[model samples]
Target: MDRTAPPLEVATATPGIAWPGLPGPAGTSLLGLLFQLDRTQWWPAERIEAAQRRQLAALLDHARAEVPFWRARLPGFPPPEDAAAFEAAWAALPILTRAEIQAADASEALLADRLPQGHGEYREIFTSGSTGRPIRGVRSQLWELVWSAFTLRDHLWHRRDLAGSLAVIRESGAGKAPYPDGDTQAGWGFSSAAIFATGPLFSLNVTTPPALQMEWLRRRDPDYLLSHPSILARLAAEVGAHPLPRLKQVVAISEALAEPQRKAIEAAFRVPVVDVYSTREAGYLALQCPDHAGLHVQSEGLRLEVLRDDGTPCAAGEVGRVVVTPLHNLAMPLIRYEIGDLAEAGAPCPCGRGLPVLNRVMGRRQNMLRLADGGRRWPLLSSGDIEKLVAAAPALRQYRIVQTGFDALTVMLAVARPLTDAERAAVIAWARGKFGEGFAVAVETMDELPKSAAGKVEDFICEVPEG
Candidate 1:
């Protein structure tokens, strides 16, 4: 045994057994992959890009030969062997959009004509439909392996306790995970369970009211809580004065974690909030850096790009559209797929990790507010602003802002009771001040604001069509 190795690297020995306890075949394979990932994370940026381009070249070749959609779009010849030429050819390829993927799927042109042997059986995956257009994609066994490896990396990077209980609150179909008394399993699912002896897993449906969810969390008293950022913020508000002392960390997934939400969750739980940027179609994109505020791109499994409208890559601190290509998904190669989200590029991290950094994953373009002058900007509403509004309107439970026109805004409030005239005025005043005086703000009280099928609620949504 290497005593100097990382704690997670050490194998769990069987009781009463001497040195070298069994980790099983599956565990052994996962550990072996993790060992490689451990080293790859430290490889210089140039070395990492060289490796990605090599894999990408093969994927591009396969796409050209097997996938009908790519066959029409990609060059007739294989990807250029030269690194610079390959990059140029890659950049020249059109960005794949969700709508295009849907069209290809309808035409049966998105999937590979044949699978590479030993890649394992195909598994179907569907996006959450948060953008109103859900995409269906196929994943090979190889993709699953990479997903698991990245999942393990996330756990290791956050230094989570595998032996500690995990509570999850996320979208689940009817009868799958019910309210109040959700579901429980013997161990944490997937990567951790496949390799380590873990604690119990508890889950509650995201549709449950925030108050009930908080009550359930207190009862379960799990060491870790995982859910969407919107849910976390609501739960944080429900916390008020009562803190979940047992929670060691909160894992925000699915949606981008806004700065206000992060601060609220951290302040409420008195625990760190780690954001994991991922999609159902493309397993893991980036994981929060353990030592810093930025998120490190999982360059080992995928190629992530932040691009400007001009089709050029964004520099450090510049915001741009997020495009991704899962390097190993040979079954359905989504080369340069635009995931329909915005993000800020980050400078190199001081942590010495070679992986690229994303300063922040801004929400989708539709979430940006469109000004009367035909310009879009992220609506600025600080946590303090929300606190003031809630304080002014004690009956308010939740609120969502929607841009109806270039100069009009609608504020939908879910309240316990009809707000007083002054409370309504306060809400309207806040919206106008946050957005702009030129915009006309209207307030509508409702029993509850509607959440997406995936149990996500955007704080702001722009309905005005882009020019």
Candidate 2:
């Protein structure tokens, strides 16, 4: 064994083997499962689906037996033990909506009978609740262990230098920055941290000014930086004005990342933008393929579906609603749950990963633009367009576009200085070009852009009627 390598025994080690100065065997064993799954990325797609079906069968059986909500709903449901039979039964189960889950007694959804079997203590987690009321759910230690495993899987898959720094800018209650530990034994908080060395983790609140964020990052000079797409876009623009020499990788999460935004960040930092698909309720769902542009579904952790409006499966290249079924999550199973997101289905990846592919995650439907012709579209804004807009208006700090009616549009901005008449006219002209010539463009200055309840900034919003 390499002396300087991660100071832990391999997964193939004997059952009771333990590292001299690290965590115990149980943590290593659990982490080893994730490491094992990391290697299974290239397993044939059918093989992965089969394993997922087996997991689904167990989840269904548990739900029917112990979950009061599922039991009452599935009174005739002793789903078959076999994979195909269970799949059919699973398909027959009604789709679960966020509203329905919120309306139902949350405790009734839990597998109470199985709680005492050493699955680890259960804890309540509230969803980000970006749209309406947040849905509350329970998670077990077993679930978190699996979650940590998947986190390790992402690290291994990306081949990140375990010793590099990871800086993140996100939301917080206390509005404080968590300084990174400069010690060599510092870990990234994954289950594998005990075995492998990890770099320091630095975090800042997203509410920090872009100038301050750049100053802080340049001072720290970290290897990787993580933030939401909107903020990253602003940071990229900031970096364009002031460069950072040490930042190597960009990890985007929380909000939907558009291709233009990814390109902007990559070009700004001269590094790859690794986008992760995840939610607060469910753990990591998929990650950007290391060798490819699209995402590789974390088949080991989730069973994802791209379905049409009618709930039928969508074909490759078709855009549809994203429905996810967490293979684990025995505490509160979210089977066939519509996460209220949209994505484009992708064909099998040439990288030889049988994991399902998503060509693009288009974000929430609420972000679409309403055209004057009664059509809704998610406009693919290019980097050049953004550059032109900012060039025309140097005072522009942030902006939001909303389509209030068929032909009327509103532009809200938080500016460093007031816009000149020519700058405002140029902005309106640019908006007219992108949206349509027939629409009326109204520009208004604001003290700040209003964020959603979950602290997300949507670049575009449409209020058109949906048939």
Best candidate per lDDT, number? 1
Cα-based lDDT for every prediction: 0.87, 0.76
How high is each candidate's TM-score?
0.94, 0.87
* Model 2 spans > 4 angstroms off: 1-22, 75-86, 105-113, 178-186, 190-192, 240-242, 370-375, 391-394, 463-467
Per-residue lDDT tens digits for candidate 2, residues 1-467, read 22333333333334554544344565676657865785678789877777777777777777878777787776454344465666666667788888778876444554445653756887788887776558887878788888878777666667676677888787765545633322122555656554555677777766677767887788778888888898898888788655677776888999889888888888888888899999978888889887887998888888898998777888999988888888778888787888888899999998888999999898876667765566567766677877877887879888888888888888888898889999999899989988889889999987668776555787777766655
Backbone clashes (count) for model 1: 0
Off by over 4 Å in 1: 1-21, 76-81
User: How far in Å is the alpha carbon of 259 misplaced in model 2?
Assistant: 1.3
Q: How many backbone clashes does candidate 2 have?
A: 0
Model 1 weakest 10-residue run by lDDT = 1-10
lDDT string for model 1 (175-207, tens) is 677777899999888777667777899999888
